[model samples]
Target: MVSSTSEPTVVRVSQKGQATIPKGLREKFGIETPGEVFVYEDEGRIVVEPVPSPDELHGIHAEGHERGEATERLRELRDEEKRREAKRAERLRPSEDE
Candidate 1:
């Protein structure tokens, strides 16, 4: 459902448990991947959040734009982390001269 709030558009879930987040709202929240965790609260109102994951926050570029994008994206992210760690350890070692 389209929202009227000036802050951020809100989508109400129907009895079928389906809700379409407004285009503007999705863009504002930067929902590039579907697995992105969302926190919600119910107190006469509903709140949504995108929980940060180290893999998502500091990972490789997204992949599989057409199919299995989520899996591909996450895999790429993990691989990126591995590469970063290797580089970090290499830099921490003492040089041969020392």
Candidate 2:
């Protein structure tokens, strides 16, 4: 399913629980077939997200790369994210001067 950003597009889901993403939405989301997308729930809604390719990430650098490299790159990205969250947390906290 596409995000709340666009007008709702009704799609018929197969009995097998698969649904075809529409062409315009696919192009908008950059969902090339023979590729994969990440599906998860957000606030009781189904969210479909494009899985970032290696070129979109640092370290691993390319597609057809090994899982280990992907894992490493993911870990690095997560760590970077944690650091950013920590900084944001600090900013949100009450300052000593307050």
Most accurate candidate by TM-score: 2
| Residue pairs clashing, model 2 | none
TM-score for each prediction?
A: 0.37, 0.54
Question: Which portions of model 2 show Cα errors greater than 4 Å?
Answer: 1-5, 60-98
Candidates in order have lDDT scores of 0.56, 0.69
List the candidate 1 regions with Cα displacement exceeding 4 Å.
Answer: 1-12, 53-98
Which candidate leads in lDDT? Answer: 2
CA RMSD, predictions in order? 16.3, 9.4
Q: What C-alpha lDDT does candidate 2 achieve relative to the native structure? A: 0.69
Q: Which residue pairs collide in model 1, if any?
A: none
